[model samples]
Target: MTEGTSNDSTSDHLSNNGRSCCNKESTNSNILDAVQTSIDSLANKEWSNVESRVLVVYTGGTIGMVRNNRGALEPKPRDLERRLRGYPHMHDEDLAKEKYPNSPFLVLPLYKEKHCIIYMIHEYSPLLDSSNMTCDNWATIAKDIRSVYKMFDGFVVLQGTDTLAYTASALSFMLENLGKPVVITGSQIPIFETRSDGRDNFVGSIIMAG
Candidate 1:
């Protein structure tokens, strides 16, 4: 997930089959109770038996951002790991809290949902912004995915909106097999922005990738 959080959002990020199906406050309580309970009666790692595999390739996005005391944006690599470990779906109280703490409906269950594997590959350029995106940069991104293609079931590409569509189209052309999704997304707002679109976009990207 990319790093960015806005306290102003009330949008429900989780749903099924395109229908809105979650409440901001109790979404987590409901989901964990649902998925975990449904799978509870089955053997361990019910997901392992699923027909498809999920590979979370977190490139860079608002979901990965944290704010410094100075109000500057910073990426917290460790927090990402912790959030995933915590499994926001396990319970609403601990993992359900918004990363920004300003938005109620932006809760993420990345901490709860399990992927076949997760990869963290930040942009190559120190100042890589989607606005200045280039073909070479896109190539590097594609190359990274291709390099890891054989190791996972599917791929997710975290990116900036400035060039999200272009990158996605290019990726579709470059990657073969197409056995799984290679979803790409970024927020209209910065992850550090009080009301940024980072969280929803991130959660959505992860869901789509899966």
Candidate 2:
């Protein structure tokens, strides 16, 4: 009787262990299935339908500066837009002509996700150097963002590097309850230069804003 009891107990213990192993395998399979489903969903997703409209606030920064007659870097209105239009990475002329003939905005080339990024430049009148950025200027920037808050998905502020941080910090406090992204960036070297950091910085900022 004692031997029979021990044998039955051992059999029950083995049965429970087998069930636990099966349960673990089932759980792992479910997790893998879930992960694969998510991967397939993203892989099959249509990204072209998505578009990001970014408002570029050109606030007279080194990125947009050009040498004047005296060889001093000065902000030139509309020059930045012209230069961007010529840059293959920044603008697609064919795409602009095909889809956005009437629009003044530029289209970024289709990249990894094939999502379209349309950006319009709003240049500040008499752009000042970063050192000249004042409280009033910050207020104006905030108000400009507020006025078109609903129109665009995000905003990129291109300012001089001298006071870029200060302007960013000031805007943070001035623009209340802002839900959209606001990117402030500038390069030590002008974008017009052959070897300049502005290209990457501007492109990255636009992507981030989008």
Candidate 3:
């Protein structure tokens, strides 16, 4: 399960995966439904004239996992960006003409037609497994987001499912007076897999974060 927090209805941020095969057609429909629901929900809402930017704090998880020489899933630095870029649904080069070389963030442009979301992915170096998540790690994520609070319109936290609920709770408390969306999501299967839930999860987060 993934949880998100906002001033809107609590049900808006809930996402769960049941036991079933990954049907791409069904997945596409579900993704579109989620996007449509979000757009409809925002019909009466107000937004600024500036382009929407979301800060994605990816703190290591199965979503970014890649197979090693031994064919075992493991966290690999920089692999997430490569994988995401390979997916057409996740990256748009024209919208990301400007790049920050010194930053660890990958800017993504989603939904180019209208109501676009320009998000940045900040993947942690030397990724840590969910089992190693602790108070200190939580604090690090909080501080990182706080450090750039004024830059983005919303935020997303991607982590391993093993400790996703805990981090979500911790972040909810850590960010005081949070006016934007904060979504915490992860996948049970590696994103590189053909039947993985990561694609939808990532796209849905972008819609909410926008």
Candidate 4:
């Protein structure tokens, strides 16, 4: 009788375990379904009114360096913009031509809620390596941002990875009463190379700036 009782208890336990497993799976499925529904609703929603303008201060960095005749990486003027234009993920030339023909800025493809992000690249006259960056340069960048503070929703500063932390720290102290977002980024490898981190770094910075 005790053995039979023991067997019955085991059966009941197994049945309860099976139901518990099924309940957990059902709960997980419901959560997944709810997440999918939210995603679908967001995908279908109209985001025509949302727009962002960002100012990209291209202050010479490894991100835009190109190979020289000697096969050494060096900062090249106007190269970054050209390369960015060629990258479809970075610049939406079609959209720029259609709606912002007269604008000096480039448009990013509609993403996340279909919001448009238009950005202007202000390349430095003489791009310098981050190792050569000084407090004066930081001041110049701060002033530039101040000059166009009202024109953009956010700011992105592209510089060399070397001394990036120092530049960021300097800017934080220089730019007073700043209400807008300022994103500083750089890549270890030159953007001109086939395998470079510049694409992701720049794209992320642009998105954060916007």
Candidate 5:
């Protein structure tokens, strides 16, 4: 009888051991950490990867806006991470917070990622719509790019799609590098809109950099 009790205790111990091992194997990786890893691998550990740096000169566009309670569009200044999800940084509003636990990219017309430093030089102006854009703005934007041109491997400009052609043409005259890539793109509809044509073009631009 004493031997039988000892055998049962051994069996229970083994069963518990098996359950503990199973629990660990079944544990899931953190979603944010996994996403960050994917971004890293895609970047190849240069800085986040190995070789080059891409820059995004976020020079005002529909890509960084939000509608007010009264339904007016307004600028929502944010970093690349929050912009990818189309939300403000450290926003505590319930609706805003809920809308962006995931990625915040808009369906804006021009969000292509290229191979270089992702620098987003912004417009001092609150609104970035092309209709409200001007020649002086273009000149100023070009001047700024020239100033910081040395700090980056490449540059991507975010502007109103309606005026991307003009800005791109203007910037071409401004740049002297004869070196890396300089891509400009924008959209008619807001990228977050249902009718937005932004996703593929933006994604395509990112792949182009690689």
Candidate 6:
């Protein structure tokens, strides 16, 4: 009687174990499928097959700032994209055009015959300023670049100069086997101003990144 009772208990435990394992596997599979669907939806755009692809990681800084209701400069989300799109000189559509009579082009300037920059920005939400940067912030920036390192020809880091020196130094060690250019720059003034260092820094970084 005692042996039978022990056996029954073991069997019941194993039965529950099997069910729990199956449930966990099903949950994992569903999560994976959802992730894949999201990735496919986001990356469905056709590529131009540009030789040079630069990834600009806009962490945040003075360059992307504007005066808020408090009358103080603060980083605005997505404002960098708006500013860049509006500034023809910063990203000249004419420059991106190939010499050929009919061809599609963007803002990037063609560097050699085939080394034109086709870049994308990955801006952080609630952009960080140089002063507020921490070790984790540096890690995030380094990891961001590492995640898509192979896909790009170069990288441009738009960050505040206040802590740029330390951040750059940290990245040098964190990023291993770097075979491409990684240009880090920030403007002393806001890009929205008519006469600002932002234009030069931005344009220069793009050219260098390409």
Ranking by lDDT: 2, 4, 3, 6, 1, 5
Comparing 5 and 6 by TM-score, which wins? 6
Report the lDDT of model 3 for residue 29.
23
The local distance difference test score of each candidate is 0.46, 0.69, 0.63, 0.69, 0.45, 0.62
| lDDT tens digits, residue span 1-210, model 3 | 232344432222221111111222111123233323433433233224335767677789998888899999888886676777667668765544433222223445545566566555676765768877876677666656544555667778889998888887766656545567778889988777889898889888877887
Q: Please give, for residues 1-210, the per-residue lDDT of candidate 6 as tens digits.
A: 001122223333323333433233211123233323323433334233455666677889998788899878888897777667667766655554433113222356554665556566677766887998876676666556545555666778899989989877766655544566788889889888777998788777877776
lDDT per residue (tens digit) for residues 74-184 in model 4: 888977877788878889999877666555567788789677897767788778788987656776676566555555678899999889999877666555345568899
- Alpha-carbon deviation at 68 in model 3, angstroms: 1.6
Better of 1 and 5 by lDDT: 1
Off by over 4 Å in 4: 1-50
lDDT of 1 by residue, 84-103 (tens): 43444322434223222221
Candidates in order, TM-scores: namely 0.52, 0.73, 0.69, 0.73, 0.52, 0.69
Query: Over 4 Å off in model 5, which ranges?
Result: 1-49, 79-81, 85-127
Clashes in model 3: which pairs? none
lDDT of 5 at 125: 37
lDDT of 1: 0.46
The residue-by-residue lDDT of candidate 2 on 1-210, one tens digit each, is 001122223333323333333233111123233323322333223223337878788878789888899999777886888888988889999987766655666888876667788777877777777897666676666656655555667889998888988887776655534557889999988887889999899999988888
Per-residue lDDT for 1-210 in model 5, tens only? 001122223333323333343233221123234324434433233333323444455666665455679987566665434546443211223432333223221222222342222322333434467767665565555444444444445556667777777776655544433355666766555555555665444445543432
